[model samples]
Target: MKIYSSIALSGVAALMATTAFAQGGTITINSFGGAYEEAHRQCVIDPFEAETGATVQIVTAYSADAFAQLRAQAQAPQFDVIHFSGGQEIVGAQEGLLDPIDPASLSNAADLYDFAKSNLEAGEGPAYSIAAIGMIYNTENAPEAPSSWTDILDEAYADHIVLTDISNGYGMLGFLMLNQVQGGSLDDIQPGLDAVSSLLENGAIIVSTSPEIQQEFAQNDAWVAPYASDYAFTLRNAGLPTAFVQGEEGTPASFITANLVAGRDNDELALKFIDMEISPEAQACFADALRYTPTNSKVELSEEVAADVVYGPDAVAGLLRFDPTVIEANRADWVDAWNRTIAQ
Candidate 1:
């Protein structure tokens, strides 16, 4: 059974107000590749193509690399819309590579969470969906759910913990949460650095990628790790005994945003694409398939998916988000500190 919010964007209001029928054209955007690329097709791309008659080209570039590509091609923009799974939209806006999104221009904008439109007032892209970064633990090894981020630090779970490197998005959020719980803000991350040192000293194992964490949990007997919520569902589906947590200190959110390229010739088409992305139907597709919590207030999810992700306004309200600009600014120093801590 499908349920949705009352304040609706009709087919006309949702897509385009100026045109009666969609005239066919080509638009381009970056892809995270592999399964995500396929999910993109299912959630937004194919439906968009069928309706608008637009050919959407895919550039296989993840967030940081995609931003680099945007900077390189700023003078002659190739991708009409850039999908920033990482929060590069903030940095991209500052560089003028991204056009500020006016929430008024999109019909569905009114139905988004306040945080979803927080950046819109500044002409930045709105987050279409969010995923939380929290604790992922093996039920077999740790039957009790952890109450706080510090639980991973306990010597009892020392060697069993999997520490993902901070360069990765999931790792970055996980580390940021650790740092925040340790009284480290984006400016003063030393406390977090100290915590990592103690964690390493206590015998935490370091892994660099998401898949690596899965391997540790499955074959290496990893008890717990700080990772994304959706991935915990992935682990559970992989036949591992696992569960996710939003630690008491707070949870960090990873936003998947769609942005407009500043000089792109297809503002109309691009806006339509962004509109479709935030549409209840498309957002529900992401929720069902990826466990991505919808940023659009109108989208509804089944009970199972809702339970796995941070859903609804109240839950989303408790989520923590560090400024993307700050993270982008201090990233180099943070990674260096992380490396230095692990080296000793």
Candidate 2:
């Protein structure tokens, strides 16, 4: 869900469509678990159940799991709606595991930004929320947030910076972003490897999990890390004095989408669920709870919440997206190189 070009969140806000009362039916949707599921329940499920009179069952699953399940159950699909945070929706749509949502059928479609609608042309679902990944710094130690991605390599932060391992999504994204800032690309990740090699040698703590990052910050005098915007809020909520900043160069976004599953008897209920997620109420609820930026143009964010996300058109314009095709093509070799050069 790359914003190929900037689309200003211009003009007056669109009126929110009324959530219609729906008939009784059961639909299943997969959710990214833990806080993502919690937020989903608050923002989408609770309201959707109330409005639609449908029993919505949520299975805890991530991108790969959702796609795998979809593929295995292509004939007798278990899911009616799917949530993807890692571009699985694109592949699922291509593989015919997911259905292309018709904007004409969903009333809230009119309020979405152009970028959100971009995937619809390719028969993929529109992004309902975006999670920005940027510099997550310990404010007490680094009172002034680092200005750029390269600042992670500055000697001033030696032994105090946390670098996620390439196996983890955030690590891969952070590395890709740094690779770009260092004049590298998917075809050439040498720059990032070289830079990160030095950081690892000079005492950068490398971890494979998000909780390890929290431990580093809490127990090891860690100062900064490259992580998602929501985790930064999670860190702050845990009583860590952390603040996030999109590097001057740019920041990467995790495009999370609500997709309709194909070959389902509960299509109406599924589309209703999708519409609820894209609505202002659901979008704003997710934002307030998880700091995920809204894709629906009509959702008005509070100033405080807006500060935590990629809020305005300028920020969205600068949102960097890694081509999943390129990434999937080269990831195995990249992982091998990471093991040989940087992971140790």
Candidate 3:
């Protein structure tokens, strides 16, 4: 059965009433596991539940595994929302697995940055999702901070760096950065594969799970990790010596696209949730607590926080946004080449 049908959205009054009654309906959300998940609970899910009186059932998995599960259940999706990277979103949209977003229903559409709007347009032909900001490191590790991607690979920080396993999204992004640095096109990222292989050869430890990385940093087992800007903020707040550095080549950006499941029973409620997810208040809370760059242009962030986010004018200017279409089309070849190169 379609999961959307399960959502009851008779009207705003009903929504309020359902909330007041503590009706105990659940909205399943899929996300990356561990600290990132915990951060979401603190920043988004908990507040959303308190306000709407809806129980949020979170499902955690690696992005690739999550996408595979979503595709497997295309006829009857399980989760109300799936948080995925831009490449996965592009592939899903191209395959007709995602529903287009209606801007009119989303009151916070007016607040979205032009880049976020444009990114949504290019990915799903409408504002199907908000731009999810990512960054490389946390400030506690490097107080002065290296200003570019080159710094991550520098001799000074070599042994001190910790990176995600090859299966993770950030690892893939690291590959993309290597490809760019080695003058390889995003369409053919073999150079990136070589770079990562070199790192692995050079004794770069791969921590596949977010919790492990968080713990490592917390215990001072490692000083730096490649992670999302929001996640980096989370580590910082947890008293880890971490900081995000804008790559000299440019800061890299990614997104978490929203999709309406096909044949879901409660399409309206699903849409309403999507609308609420993009609302100014929700976005502001996400930014303030999670340290992610809010896509909504209307939300005003303080100078201190704004300086750390990836969407600010200077940050955006320094960002090198990858083209998802190219990545999606070439992923298989890229993965195959990566496997062969890294295996050696």
Candidate 4:
């Protein structure tokens, strides 16, 4: 809620050993905007700055847009650290755009779950948060709660489904999950495309933004959708008559990660910042505020918050994740295929 324009001089003085005080101990970071940004500001960034005497300037970007900026600034990276949704961090690692986080360097590394630590190769980043792609249905209008991804195609919900754009983080995830559900592999997404085409024919609405989906639900009688758990929480928190459910087949989650920029000058400070992010306090703040599944095994949540997120090792083991390297390489082709086969 509170955005710091500059770090306090005292804080800057404290961090002078590892990072020079420049522009008020400021460092740029890339992440998502809106409600998620607010949560990060309150939960992670604010506390990190308070403790370290640094200022984090958030530059909101996600998925494709985040990658585009990183690619464009390959020679002179603008962000000191970047947070990526899904496995984009893997792509960033492959392209030499990010710095590898040495587990030995982080004191909190031992506290993280095995899956979080094993997110990337030796030099890649680690997972900070987990959010699954699942189904959201308005309880007021839908006859029954959705139990699987296939429920979106049912005639009972005809002309009542709102879908996010495949180019977006969660949308692309939904696309891939549907592909797998219908017996299609990553390379052969035709089955997923065909399923979407059927949904389109049934009068499903393709929405490009979160606000659009909210509007559709408010005005178009859109009662259900396939989306990430975090956004579903956002909707429900805003007083929408909604509930989120992982598909019976399984939930596919995106592991949002923090990567140090390749050429950043403040490597030591950046690593310290990342360490604070995965700390139990920070992780709990996000889970309590936004229902984002924490990667830190030590983070504890209340029964209500725990009920919404994929909590504990057992819940996590049931979720699926795609190969970031594979998805990154074929993303453009898949997006084009989505447009050609369904978006049209």
TM-score of every candidate: 0.91, 0.91, 0.72, 0.84
lDDT of prediction 3: 0.61
lDDT of 3 by residue, 263-343 (tens): 555555555566656655555555665676666555667776665576555556655567767766676777677668756
> How much is the lDDT of residue 46 in candidate 1?
76
The parts of candidate 3 lying over 4 Å away from their true place are: 1-66, 78-81, 119-144, 193-225, 302-304, 323-344
lDDT of 2 at 170: 76
lDDT of 4: 0.80
- Whose lDDT is greatest here? 1
Per-residue lDDT of candidate 1, residues 1-344 (tens digit):
13222223343342465343355588999988987788888888877766665689999999889988899988998999998877888878878888887788888999999888787755578788888888898887874778699897787887888989999878988888898888888878888888888888877888998899999999988888999888988999999998887888888988889899999789888898899899888888888877788988877788888878888888887788878778878889888888888888
Candidate 1 residue spans exceeding 4 A from truth: 1-21
**What is candidate 4's CA lDDT for residue 52?**
77
lDDT per residue for candidate 2 within 83-110, as digits (tens), equals 8878787788888877877788788998
User: Per-residue lDDT of 102-177 in model 4, one digit per residue for the tens?
Assistant: 7877878899888787744454677788887888889899989989888887899989888888888788888788
Clashes of 1: 1
Candidate structures ordered by TM-score, highest first: 1, 2, 4, 3
- For model 4, the stretches where C-alpha displacement exceeds 4 angstroms are 1-26, 61-78, 119-121
Which segments of model 2 are wrong by more than 4 Å?
A: 1-21
